[model samples]
Target: MSLLLEREDATLEIVDDSVLTICGEADFDSAGPLAQAGRHWLAEQPAQTEVSFDLTGVQIASSAVLSVLLVWVRSVQRHSLRLNRVSLSPALQRLMDITELAPLLPAVETTCAEPARDRR
Candidate 1:
């Protein structure tokens, strides 16, 4: 799994105050890097940091990965930071819907109007 955490499109222009944008895959194997990058950014910022997770590139994710993401979200909430603009895959969206995690994941937005076909 490829996980890249960097400035979007090399623009180098900060979109929001204390906001860190993450774009890449979030899965069991890639969750470590994603979590690490998020933690590092949070540590660098003072307070009320906003982390936007762009999941447009993410193709697959497991329950473990979802748990990891939830942990990060909780940490951000505890620190009073804002987690916004979270994009999710259709499969993940369904999982969140089924598990009633949509309320917890307020930052995540549904990109797919229809439910994804479950391969599992």
Candidate 2:
């Protein structure tokens, strides 16, 4: 795992060079730097074709956090990388649901410990 950006209330890191895990609280005060750092990290990774974001550690899902996620979405597109998954925290999920942005984010609800099974 590699540390990408660290703020007073949050941290961004890349795990196995593919999973970007964001933890703690983030607001408008920290959004810009977080987004900028994410872009830089994406640019530096030339061998990564797919990426996943683990936002489950986030404690505060503010609009600024959503903005950061959007920035990441755009960055991955600009870098010619596929966004394989985005694991959201309950707070983030509610924000996405309220904003009707779930479709845009491609949220993944499965855990990595086991294979995804059919519910029906």
Candidate 3:
């Protein structure tokens, strides 16, 4: 049997009002770390703070990663915190469209300047 390995490179920046900008690869195996960091940041913030996910650097996101994102959104909603300013790659946007989850998440700006081929 062969083992599979997944790697994720992500950076988290805490903006005002507890909005955290997440940039980097959010893949199947890396979703856990990303979610953990997000949750940790939320816990550190005061009540009624928003957490914005910036996907400018995200190259690829698998279904698992999307699921993680949904879960995080739900958690934030439950806490009465707001979620805004989510960016996604074209591939991810397509996936969201296919799954009809785009309406649930915040509207994404389609200004990602990175080439599709360059993203991975």
Instruction: Report the number of the highest-lDDT candidate.
Output: 2
Superposed model 2: Cα runs more than 4 Å off? 106-120
**Candidate 1 per-residue lDDT over residues 67-100, each given as its tens digit:** 7567667767777776666656676667767777
Please estimate how well model 3 matches the true structure, expressed as its whole-model Cα lDDT: 0.60
Candidate 2 similarity to native, TM-score:
0.83
RMSD of each: 7.4, 6.4, 7.2
Per TM-score, the best of the predicted structures is 2
TM-score of each: 0.62, 0.83, 0.69
| Sequence-dependent TM-score of model 1 | 0.62
Over 1-120, each residue of candidate 3 has an lDDT whose tens digit, in order, gives 111222446555554544445556767667777777766666565666655655555667578667866776777776777665666667677777789887777533323334333323
Q: How do the residues 1-120 of candidate 2 rate in per-residue lDDT, one tens digit apiece?
A: 788888788888887778887777778888888888888887766644778887777778799998998998888877777788888778787888899877776434423221122111
lDDT of 2 at 96: 81
**Better structure of 1 and 2 per TM-score:** 2
The residue pairs in collision within model 2 are none
Cα displacement (Å) at residue 63, model 1: 0.9
Residue 85 deviation, candidate 1, in Å?
Answer: 2.5
Misplaced by over 4 Å in model 1 are 1-25, 106-120
Residue 86 lDDT (model 1): 61
